[model samples]
Target: MGLERVIPVAEKLGVTRPEAKVLTVAGTNGKGSTTTTLAAILAAQGYQVGLYQSPHIYRFNERVKINGIEVDDQVLVEAFVRVDQARRDCQLSLSFFEATSLAAFLIFQQQQCDVWVLEVGLGGRLDVVNVIDPDVAVITNIGIDHVEWIGDTIEKIAFEKAGIIRPNIPVIFAGQQALPKAIQDKAQACQATLYAVNRDYFYQDADDGQHWNFASSGSTLRLPLGHLALDNIAAAIAAIQVSGLDVSEQALVTGIRNARLAGRFDVRQIAGKTVIFDAGHNPHGVEFLLKNLQKFMKNHDQYTEILSIFSMLGDKDINSVVKLLKGCILKWKIAELNVPRAASLAELNSALHTENNVEQFENIKAAFESALAEVKDNQIILVCGSFHTLEAIWECLEEWQ
Candidate 1:
């Protein structure tokens, strides 16, 4: 639950500290994309990179990767053996996240990664990934999420997100909103150089909308857009530039073009239907998805109708998320997720509140199948609401393939 419990076991396993350059990223939404892009950039430059992320969409192996490839089962098994032995020696009970994070560190250490790109599993202060001090800490963005664990207010959440900043290390803030006072205070206390997105670095879509340009201080580069969010991609570039590493502009462009995460704005054509899978569970994340969807609609001929397969966790603000997308979503195919904290059909209906263009299914697979069966030409299907919703569809797609 706290560092006191996990740090001892990490030290016993020889992973309390890292020898590789560490870039720890923490945020409510863009952690996965940012970390993936960072790793791609570093790897493009020929550095052995280790990326550790959480809440894998398909397999547990997706949570750990070396040089853009998921670690093999034998690697994971070996790391787990060491972690289990260390935990037993320490006589401490580690949470699933803590134990897995230690295993990732062990793998990265044993592989002798040149750069370790880690995504904070939750709030930065007490999250298991914070056990290692980052050479350059990046806070992708902050929002009112995990209110129960972090805090109810934006300031409190930002405070927790800023916890990864160490004394005199460079800190990057890429949130859309203005800098929170909590982040300012923490940066000043740590004397970490702060780089706010708009003030210190900037990224803007080109007039053609095919490419984007990133500028920081006196240096600037035009790069091709990737499947991930351009803001997060730009932040990754900025983080690497500030890390004092030798990364060429060519490598930056290659990395951005190569960076792709499975669930974030993932678009595909299956059986001649356009389907988008986004893991935007909260209001802020949903807003980002809406923007991307609008752009997608603009690029293609306007669809006659937009159908959405949606479900969310019980703790999320379902009402707010549904409210945000109701205008664009012509019809809804709701499903009950199989997870413990999944929202029930009743909960989803109560949140809808008489919108009425809805059909309920027993599970996500059925809901997705129904959506696919009912699809007409020029109609788009959006599978979103939570990662679990997309995971079900992804598993189904894998099976079909």
Candidate 2:
């Protein structure tokens, strides 16, 4: 929860100050998307980009990447060895996350990347990724997810997220909602140039659905739509425009089109039926998922019914998520996740007590398999609630393949 332990170790490893241009992203939601887009755009512009994201969906190697390629196991082993030696020399014990993050930093430093796009693992102030000073800071949005670790209120969370802002750097508040006072205050205190979405820059879905428009003070780009959210992509563009990088319009276009992350409205076909794998565990994330779901339903009107293979962590606001999704999901196929933080079956039952058509399973695989067998031509299945939930289904799909 604090940087006291990791700072000395980072110093010992000689990665305290990054040689590459750094963009550190902190927010409750959209951090992955923003970082992905940032890395893609930079790489598209021919820069050697190092992207470090947290809580990889399938593999630990997914956490550290250079130009969209995950580093090999040997590379990770070598980096971890170096990090372990550094920690032992400093006579400090690093948490699993702290140790892994320091290893990513070491890899990026050694690889001599032109740019580093770092995503804050948890709250921004003391998170391991905040060890490096960023050339540009990006706050995707302030939401209520990590209340126990951050704070109960939005302002408090915003304050923690604002910790990534450095003096005189360009900070982008890409939240669609009104700016949080904590963020405004922190930016002012640091004298950082703040760019709030819909204030200093804006993005809107094009009527054609194939393109979106981004407009700032002087530039407007009609970009091709990609799988990720527009707001996050817009934040990436805003960061690059102020990053002093030599990115052109073509790079921005190519990057937005290229950026893709697993479990983020990831639509695919399985068993001749459509399935959307989304890792939206919180209310804010679910709202975004619903918006995209609604768009998909509108375009493909034949898909009349929506079913879900769902479960969540016990710490999350499961009731709120169920309430948001209940209106659209016709049938809920749920199971208790096989994780330490998984919600209990009793808790899942209680949250979904009001639902009319609900089916409970012993595990995520059975629930997903049931949905696959029963889904009709005019129906679609949505696998969501937690990344662990998606991982369960992914294991099943991989075995079948």
Candidate 3:
């Protein structure tokens, strides 16, 4: 509902304003990766760090982590108990996101974390995580997803994300797209120093394509490549730099090399086949996935067939994303996800638009099994579309193991 509902419970739980340094990340994409990298770097610097992210791939414990380790079930259960009691005393109802976020705050507060890295679950201004004012607010990128909840235009979405900016704080805009005026105006109104990517800070591939360089007016760091995207890594570094935190160069490099998020461009060798799992359901995210896929292909042997296990939520822009990916995907194994917003077979077929290299399955496990059985030595199977799509396959793999 409103921030008022969660704020009171958070205050009652003694987590409304954490004593630790807060770095809040918000965007249409890259929020999870950026937050993960930030926490990893701070932890590498020997700080007690707490990280909170959303839409976990496998387990609920993945939502709350300390020192790069997912907290145990007992920790979450304890925090949830506290939050539930507080909410009951306040007589307020919370959505799953709001309740879990407050629980994360309670855990971080109890652990006495040195740094709190929070990922905004949705639009920034109204998100439960925004209850704590961030010392460094990072907007990884803005895209036209979540239009039904946020807005239909990029500017409108930017305005909602800009709600995370606070007075006299450092704001990092790392979106590759043009800088939205709404963000600039909000930064000005708040008197926050804005470090827009490609303007205040820059990143490029070094002489060796394997490594990259990040340069700002304050410092320059040559970093090793990691599992996440370079832009997100750079954004995390910039936020740390502006945060006035004491992070060593070694910590920066080591953390960059060590940081990993499960479903973003995740690769695995399963059943003698090359499989990639990504949670890119929107056009912008899919575009990023394609670029990384192209790079992977360039560095490795070409696959004779690129088969995709695809599904999407009904709210997403399925047509644009399908068209953007059609050029690279040779065949598609579409399945209907068992979620309230999942797309129907008819809707998926409409998006396909005469692409005959397609097969429909009743569920994700069957589609994945068919892909595994049919994939040959020279074939690559891509599991994508939504987080739900990847989560289904991951759960199935766990069961089989």
Candidate 4:
């Protein structure tokens, strides 16, 4: 839960501070999207960029990338060997995440990347990503997630997320709610100038919906929308603007257009059905998912019924998530995920007790198969609830491919 275990190993591995400009992003929901977009923008400006994110969708190689491409297997293996030897020399025990993160840092340093954009795998203050001081820090948003490890309330979580702030650096808080006192206090103590969304910078969808605008005190630019949510893209843009990096406006446009994240409203035509794969497990995340789903239904009015293939981790707020989607989702096809913290069938059933059109299956694959078999031309199938759920479906669909 703290960096005490990783710092010594990082120092031994010589990745405590690499020779590269660093930007660290911490939050519950949008860390992946924000980091991906930030890396894309840096790469668009012709900088060699290294992006490190967590909880890969389909492959472990997805966690580390160079200039928008996943690093090769041999590179990762060599880095792992070095990281293992370093930890052994330090007489320290590194968790799986700690070892993998150190390896990613080693790869970035060895490649001599111009910039490194790191995403916090959990709450920020004690995360391994905090081992290196970032030139710019961005907090995408804070929510009541990972309560066991972080905290139970918004303020508590905010305090942990604010741990990434450093003295004299630009800190960006992009939460839609009012800035938490803990974050404000931490930033003030660090003497870091904090730029909050809506207060210091703002983003709004343009009238055409095909483009959006980002405006701060000094500059304004209208850019094309990407596959990700607008708020996340806006946060990435704000981080880059305050980063003081030599990035042109065209690079921003090109990066925004090229940035794509899997399982964040990822749309695909699979098995003769329009399926949307989203990794929204908490209430805050589900709210964003609902917003996107509503807009999609509005544009494609032909989709009358929405069928969902959903499963979640046991520790999540299942009832609230179900409440959010039950109204829009006409039918639910649920199963227990094959993960350690997966919610059992009893838990999912108890949460969905009020719903009438519920269908149970053996596993996530069967649930997805049922949804696809029953989906019609006018209906959409949504695979969501957890990243594991999406992984299960992707693995199953790989055979069809």
Off by over 4 Å in 4: none
Per-residue lDDT of 241-281 in model 2, one digit per residue for the tens? Answer: 99899999999889989999999999998877899999999
The RMSD (Cα, Å) of candidate 2 is 0.9
| Global lDDT of model 2 | 0.93
lDDT score, candidate 4, position 324:
89
Tell me how many clashing residue pairs each candidate has: 0, 0, 0, 0
Model 3 Cα lDDT, one tens digit per residue, 361-394: 9899999899888887778999999999998899
For model 2 the local lDDT of residue 309 reads: 94
Clashing pairs in 4: none
TM-score of 4: 0.99
- The sequence of per-residue lDDT tens digits that candidate 4 reaches over residues 288-338 is 899999899999999988999999999999999998888988898999999
Query: What's the TM-score of each model vs. the native?
Result: 0.98, 0.98, 0.98, 0.99
lDDT of 4 at 316: 97
Indicate the residue-level lDDT of 261 in model 4.
Answer: 93
Clashing pairs in 1: none
Candidate with better TM-score, 3 vs 4? 4
Cα TM-score of candidate 3: 0.98
When 3 and 4 are scored with lDDT, the better candidate is 4
